[model samples]
Target: MMRFILSLVLLPTLAAAQTPAADQARAAADALEAASNMLDDADGARDRVRALTETIQAFESGLGAMRTGLRQAAINEAQLTKKLQSREEEVAALLGALQSMGGGASPVALLHPDGPMGTARAGMLLAELTPALNARADALRTDLENVQTLRALQTDAAKRLQEGLTEVQAARIALNQAMANRTDLPKRFTADPVRTGILIASTETLDGFASGLSEIVTDEIEPAPVNLDGQIGELRLPVQGLILRRAGEADAAGVKRPGVIMATRPGAIVISPTAATIRYAGPLLDFGNVVILEPQADTLFVLAGLDVVYGEAGQVIAGGTPVGLMGGSLAEKGDELSPLREGTGTERSETLYIEVRQANRPQDPVAWFRTDEDG
Candidate 1:
């Protein structure tokens, strides 16, 4: 009879061990495994650089989902543990009561001292208490099992995270090598170094420098092959990140710029938003490494604060081409999981500054790029 009661109490715990957070963690692990396979296939791909880029992106998304799931799992485990600890005495008392009832079930113990009527009333009381006892036992078993499952999940997630980090690093290196070997991108025009140098030295601001771009080229420039006016507000962000500031928002230093700032993880890839010719691809005063592209005759897209830049000035690169990488170092192994447990996910430590200039005037970047708050 006691064994039957115990089995009934634990029946619900056999349903499933996976919570929503655990399911998400499993899905993220699957994604990471797929990305690893993609990395292996990239070597023989027709466009190896693009294939590797996609692999890196996949790893990034998987890592993010894993972190979120792990964080949630940690929180759930802590709550269950606290609840169990607070009710420790109550649980012990219940266990002692059950043990006594099972051990002392002799005929003499079953008979009440008062009479047959008293014994009948005691039997009725036991029937009423059975359901309540069963319910509490079931709840306690479930909580204990859930905590155990969550702990196991957290331990397994660490291994997945390490593999993902290593694979992404490999993908990034492969992409860099492939980009260096690439030679097929078309050239719109060749830049004049002396003229460009003179123009930069004479200009005082970005607007003035952009306005004098024509002064650096003496040859008759051909019209842009692609038009981007139809794609306004439909372009995806160059990097996967969250927008930190819209255009004209003041910074901590009380300074404002006509650009949007995006917060991205370390080593994030930055791609071109549209098919455009590189007007300039080097450092400018106070903007760090910068890439300026002209999709049309009078419009310029400026991406700044990159750690590394790609492509050369006057190259006509297609949309979604790799142009740069955001700056930061990857987290050290074993230490990376701590941030996820704390619910911060390594701080999104790098920032990309984006600006759109039309007709020599700075325009709001949100007007050109689609914004997603959740990214």
Candidate 2:
């Protein structure tokens, strides 16, 4: 009887243990489903955002044209006003002359003794003057009418421009809301190890494809230099960082290989390669924010994935000049850890990728560095 009682109690305990496990499994499945749904929603949201941005750009262009039209209209109106005022003055002067002549002053009294001929000449002058004054008045009236018409048209255009701007603002607000709503989706999905790993692998695959194309281009096509000059070499780290990758191998993306791969802690400064002109300063695919420097006329030094570019294109930079700040990659978040490095301690660290190209072909960057030392 005691054994039977013990079996009954143990049976209940075992059933309860299975219940929690089942609940946990169900919860995980639900979470995964939610993540999948979120991905679909994110894609839709991204499309909407892109559409809205384009619409906003179009509206901005229209607004610019409207502004130009408005300015020209204003100038036209000013000129018309001046012309109208001058015409009014001429009309007033002619009216005064007519009133004085009609007020019983003899035609001879109106003319100076030394002025031109006889009664026949004076009468002829009076006839011409009367018609000339009337024609002047008519022309002024017509000009005023045309000015009013143009002003009305300009006013309508201004109103339309205002409406367009309002629509653009509304669209922008909607886009912002959509983007905000979808922001959490990526985070939720990426938090899972499986999903994160998949994303990283996919990124790598895409990068490899891009690298392959770059290699083909680099091999087949040579970019002629606009100018050629002295060799620049021995580039020191703009800031300290670990070398993530070297220039020798083609990138996994199958593009032209970078000269060197350097990763830095977030906020690390990127210094100039040498005294050079900044050829390019903007975003590049996979590289994030990038700055390209022409150290010598023919040499192109690329700096990619920066937080900010400090100089403008065409601006000259001196050696060791801070060109940009290193930014954290969206793929990973930490104190800018370099995947190439094997340590976990808190030392100031960075990863730098360096490359040297001559006549659009890859050259040994090590040789350049060594040559600088020899010089």
Candidate 3:
């Protein structure tokens, strides 16, 4: 009977362990699915860029072929010229001799020599050289025509390539605009100044940021929560980038922290993960520029290592909202936006540091807040 009771106790303990393992497995599967979706979206953009590249490469290849054709035409022209040089000189002298005899002179007079035998020899030589001179002249003309055709092909390719480049730029603009149109999350919390200040002071470290969030009370009206608490592995990344560092990973300074480091594009737009109040928005020590956000009542999210930031302290930012623009080169010119190069997964212009804390204690963001991306 005692053994039976022990078995019963062990059965509940085993069942509890299995339940968490199953939840974690489901979370991991969801994360993978999300990541696949993100990759698919990225591929769509890459296809556009790839099309532009293919057009250019084909144009370049055509130009190269044309150049080769032209070179070959030059070689043909040179060979034809060599074969006909003597014929050209002979014809010139023959015409001069005939001119001296007058336009009314007979063909026999032009061939007049010291004797009948010499005259016969001259006529025979002219007969043989005539056909060869005619053939060489035709060959030289064909070579010139080929060279001209090649030149025209090269010019046409260059013109088409320029037009294609213009289209590529237009596509890039359209893509950026389309991406901009996607953020439509509704704001749920109002940022109050009194709370924002205390949050900022307490936000210096991950621990302090989490524990001191209640210093400023947030007013929630609609409570349009993204429900980040239950989302498990279905969280959207604040930015598209490769994860360079993960939570608990030692930094170059050998300090282990609860955050992930991401490599992003120049002038990338930073978005809020969930509807929340901006606890702080300004520069911080060693972080370049920092934007602290409070996503949950007891949770604080810290984003640092920005070149520039947008929005201000005490601002209510919605989930998927563009909180700020990253620094690096979104450095805008008067009215023109610079083009973004195609990502080969090697070109990262800026690094963003992300951290999550609940109730004033650092937690592994990778485990709590899941993203579709590597981080």
Question: TM per model?
Answer: 0.91, 0.33, 0.44
lDDT of each: 0.82, 0.49, 0.53
Where in model 1 is the C-alpha error above 4 Å?
1-15, 218-224, 340-346
After superposition, the stretches of candidate 2 with alpha carbons farther than 4 Å from their true spots are 1-233, 250-258, 329-342, 345-352, 370-375
Please give the lDDT score at residue 204 for candidate 2. Answer: 50
Provide the lDDT at 294 for model 2.
59
How far off is residue 115 in model 3, in Å?
55
lDDT of 2 at 367: 50
lDDT of 3: 0.53
RMSD of each: 2.7, 30.7, 25.8
Q: Best candidate, lDDT-wise?
A: 1
Candidates arranged by lDDT, highest first: 1, 3, 2
Instruction: Tell me, by TM-score, which candidate is best.
Output: 1
Between candidates 2 and 3, the lDDT winner: 3
RMSD after Cα superposition, model 2: 30.7
Model 3, which residues run further than 4 Å from truth? 1-206, 217-226, 330-346, 369-375
